[model samples]
Target: MDTTRSLVYIAFCAAVIAVLAQVMIPLPLVPITGQTLAIGLVVTLLGKKYGTQAVCLYIMLGAIGLPVFTAFSGGLGVLVGPTGGYIIGFIPTAMIIGLYFEKFGYTYVHAVIANIIGMFVTLLFGALWLKLFANLTWSAAFISGVLPFMIAGIVKACIAATVGLTLKRRLQQAKLLQIIQ
Candidate 1:
């Protein structure tokens, strides 16, 4: 597509992430948020280039104190906070998911697999950051930061994969979004 349209898609996806970040199940350490689901959708729909751009834009917005992160939190402090790793991790997660689709086919199975992997990638980043920043042991981090969200993350991945692929297909058919990997 044209540059203008691509940028619009990226900006729109970033907004989607910001909006979805508010849907959360509060936890002591890191709340379960729809940010991941939005990430999955953005990458699945936009592929590597635009998908990664969208994630970066979202992170930059939050880092600049835009209240775009979970719980309406933002600013550099939030990025360096215990939960910041997950926010930062969204970048690689989007790239990896997009790469997965680029290499493999954009089928439902592939989308689900890529999204699950992306979830794990984000969890790994969050757990590691939680351990170091919070001064918690590995076991403590796993229990508090990682384990609680596994099931929920899986469910979100599946939902994102399903919805993302469906929307991508429909958009392409309608000539709304350009054909993506």
Candidate 2:
């Protein structure tokens, strides 16, 4: 891809993440959002380079108060808040997913495995942050922050893997991402 195309793809993925993040089921401690699904899609479609770029751009935008986070929240405060770790965790999550696909090939099984691991990565970060930021015990954090989201995360991972791979194949067929791989 050319520099312009790369930039456009990165920006577009970041925007998609922001938009998907708005689709959430509010919980007491942490809300379940489509951001993870978007993350999976971004990495599956763009791979490590553009995927990581997009995640970083999205985080930076949110850190700068662009209303790109859950419920349209953003800024440094949001970054340092209890749910902030989950947002920050997107970086490694994308990297791992992209790396997995890069090494293992973009098979359905691999995508599902990568996404499930990514989900756990995000959950660990969120749970730890929730513990410290919320002044809760580790178990409390696990219960309130991580446990509630596991089943949903798994479902989203499957959805992301299935949809992401399908979209990637379609995009490649369309030549939209022909030069990417």
Candidate 3:
């Protein structure tokens, strides 16, 4: 892709992630949000390097007090807060999911698998951070953050995979992606 196109993709995905972050089912410890779905979509559409770049941009924007995070919240304080780990986790999650898509090509099943793995990555960071920041036991953290979200995460991930893979295929067919090998 050209420089302008690459930048557009990064900015567009970052905006999508920010927008999706707003849609969530609030839980006690964590909200079930479309952020992960957006993450999955970003990875499936953009692949490894660009996808990761886009997510990182999103994180940095939120971190720098862009009000781009959940509930219209953002700032360095947010990054160090209870939900910060989940925010930080977006990086590795995007990279892994993007890598899978880059290697395997865009397919619905693979997108689902990649997003599932990505959710685990988010859980790891989010759980650990929740435990430490909230001063809760590991099990408490898991119960609060991970346990309640597994089924929801899986269902949402499947939804993202369906949407993202379909869009990716359409974009590819339209020659929007270079698909250089």
Candidate 4:
């Protein structure tokens, strides 16, 4: 893959992730989403620079009122909604995961660790956002916003790590990893 091809691939992956965001598995609190898996996979496969660009583009498209978020809802309202913090956190999440890939290269364990860290970042931002917007106390906001998602998030992170490592191996075998960077 050339630079242009790599960029196009990244964009396509980002679009796919955005579209996946709309296909939500409804949960009591935050839904079980495939978006974070996509984010982790993209960063692991594409490395820091292109991976970050992919997530940024995804967020930008959603923010601009494209129905690219979970439940096919978008716009500034989504940004200020209870789920907004999670959305906002995607940027840093991708960056952190990408940093791991950049520094240590792609590995299953590293991918999992990076995603675990990313989940914490998401929770931090999400809890704060919930507290501010909903006027709930820390415990209430955490219970409402973060606690329910804990187990699911860990499962998703594991899945993301597995998928990322698989993609990394495939890309490496195909000798496309160099082009991705």
Q: Of the candidates shown, which would achieve the greatest lDDT relative to the real structure?
A: 1
Instruction: Mark the 10 consecutive residues where model 4 has the least summed lDDT.
Output: 172-181
Backbone clashes in model 1: 0
Candidates 2 and 4, the one with greater TM-score: 2
* Order by TM-score, highest first: 1, 2, 3, 4
Q: Against the true structure, what is every candidate's RMSD? A: 0.8, 0.9, 1.4, 1.8
Expressed as tens digits, the lDDT of each residue in 29-64 for candidate 2 is: 789999998998889889988999999999999998
The local lDDT score (0 to 100) that residue 3 gets in candidate 3 is: 90
Q: Give each model a TM-score.
A: 0.98, 0.97, 0.95, 0.90
Per-residue lDDT of candidate 1, residues 1-181 (tens digit): 7888998999999999999999999887788999999999899989998999999999999988999998898999998998998998999999999899999979999999999999999999998989889899999989998899899999999999999999999999998976556
Candidate 4 lDDT over 13-43, as tens digits, reads 7887787686577866567677776777677
- The local lDDT score (0 to 100) that residue 170 gets in candidate 1 is 94
lDDT of 1: 0.92
Give me the displacement of residue 70 in model 2, in angstroms: 0.7
For lDDT, candidate 1 versus 2, the one ahead is 1
lDDT of 3 by residue, 1-181 (tens): 6899899989999999999999988987778888888898888778888889989999999988998999988899989988899989999998888778778866677888988998899888899999999898999999997898899889878988888777877788898876621
Among residues 3 or more apart in sequence or in different chains, the pairs in candidate 1 whose N, CA or C atoms overlap within 3 Å are none
